[model samples]
Target: MKRICSIYKSPRKREMYLYVDKREALSRVPEGLLSVFGPPQHVFDLLLTPERTLAREDIHKVLANLEQQGYHLQMPPPEEEYIEHLPDELLRRNDPV
Candidate 1:
């Protein structure tokens, strides 16, 4: 199956995204989620298919959630993951002089 999805980024959280059917928009997303998400910023629209590959998310899971729950949330990677990629110089910048 194929679906056209609208992607929105969270203003309050970096790398947090919300996906929903383009036709249905945010109508299906819960209000409580929206409150914490802090008003989604329109990012882009993408055509999703089983064969398509996503950089960080599983395409199949995203499609399944859209089909079953009408929306899918993409959360930021763990803080440790971010720290793992920091350059040694940057990591040492906070060291007490």
Candidate 2:
């Protein structure tokens, strides 16, 4: 299956994103989720296909969510994951110079 998908970033949380069908937009996302997710900032639109690959999301799962629930939520990577990638300078900020 092929679909045009729109991606939105969460203003309240870094690295959190929401994906939905371009045609359906955000209408299908529930108010509860929207409240927690904050107002979505339009990021970009992409044409998705079975053969396509996404940097952070599973393409198949995203498409399935769009088909079934009309939306896909991409939560931020865990805090540990972020710590692991922190620059040495930042990690050493508390250390003596």
C-alpha lDDT of all candidate models, in order: 0.95, 0.94
Runs in model 2 deviating more than 4 A are 81-97
Candidate 1, residue 28: the lDDT equals: 94
> Candidate 1 residues 1-97, lDDT tens each?
9999999999999999999999999999999999999989999999999999999999999999999999999999878866666887686897888
- Scored by TM-score, the top model is 1
TM-score of every candidate relative to the true structure: 0.83, 0.82
Cα lDDT of model 2 by residue, 34-72, tens digit:
999999999999999999999988999999999999999
Strongest candidate by lDDT: 1
Model 2 residue pairs with clashes = none
Deviation from native of the Cα of residue 23 in model 2, angstroms = 0.5
